[model samples]
Target: MRGLVESAEIVVADGMPLVWASRLARAPLPERVTGADLIWSLSELAASRGWPIYLLGGPPGVAARAAGQLVERHPELVVCGVDAPPYGFDACDGGREKVRRKVVEAGPRLVFVGLGFPRQDRLIAELRRELPDAWFVGCGAAIAFAAGTVRRAPAWMRRSGLEWAFRLVSEPGRLARRYLVHDLPFAAALLTSTLLHRLTTAGPPFQQPPS
Candidate 1:
């Protein structure tokens, strides 16, 4: 996963914690740029430019619903295809090839994949080989959010960087361990390390010579 991200054409800070870490490191980023927001903005650009797009992932029928929403918003947008592959579809070579062929045949200019993390990113890498001219985004749950199958945090929560709390409350059973046990500790450690690095590298306090 690290190699894949490092090799990607571009990467952005998708969470506020990452943005904060950048500031602590003295290399501040503009802001978080989330996939949930990108789906709309990118579709708008694709519409204006006449770039056909493909939607992949989410539960059955969700990709289609998201496609509908995008088209409704941008009447000029063309959704070339939508696919919601079965669970573990990428587990076998045959299944991966099947979806790869489907997307290539559709010949979209852009592809939004919402299969989550390394899986979606891995598939995007493979699909890029078959459709070298196409652009791909590993969009996580953006498709479901666009389709209204999953509710996104309110705008205020998102702006305030409390969106994770909203999601944790909404899906405690699925997310509690990830948020509390794994992510929380990792975030704390990251901030701590950044602060330590900054402090250690900082020069000594200025002293005025006797006047």
Candidate 2:
């Protein structure tokens, strides 16, 4: 995952924790830029430019529903294709090739892939090789969110950096281990390291002049 992130042409801090960590390190990012937001923004750009876009991933009807929502919002937007590949499609060369061929035939200018993490990114890399001129966004669950298939956290929860809590509550069985076991420890370590670095690098407290 780190390798994939490092290799990306552009990377933005997607979580408030990362943004806060950057501030603690005295190198604050402008703001968190999440995939959920990007889906709308990028689609707007595509619409204005008359660039055709493709939607890929999500459940059977989700990609299509997302496309409808996007087109409804941006009436001029051209959704060239929508696809929801079966589970484990990326694991087989034949299935991947079929998807690639379909996208190539559609010839969209932008492709939003919601397959999640390493899988989405890995498939984007492969698709990039086939369509060097096109742009790809590995957008995780953004498609489902756009489709209204999944409820997003409320604005206050997002602002307070508690969106993960909302999601965990919503899908506890699926997200419990990832949030509690892995992400919690990593966020703790990141903040701890940042604080230590700041403290160690700080100058000593000022001394009063001799009377």
Off by over 4 Å in 2: 203-211
Error of 2 at 89 (Å): 1.1
- On the 0 to 100 scale, the lDDT of residue 98 in model 2 is 95
What are the per-model C-alpha RMSD values against the true structure?
Answer: 5.4, 5.9
Candidate 1, after superposition: displacement of residue 26 in Å?
1.0
Tens-digit lDDT track of model 1 for 39-68:
999999999999999999999999999999
C-alpha lDDT of all candidate models, in order: 0.92, 0.91
Worst 10 residues of 2 by lDDT: 202-211
- Compute the lDDT of residue 198 as modeled in candidate 2: 83
The prediction achieving the highest TM-score against the true structure is 1
- lDDT string, candidate 2, 77-187, tens digits: 999999999999977899999988999999999999999889999888888888889999889889999999989999999988999999999999989998999989999
Q: For candidate 1, give the lDDT of residue 52.
A: 98
Score every model by TM-score: 0.94, 0.93
12: Cα error in model 2, Å: 1.0
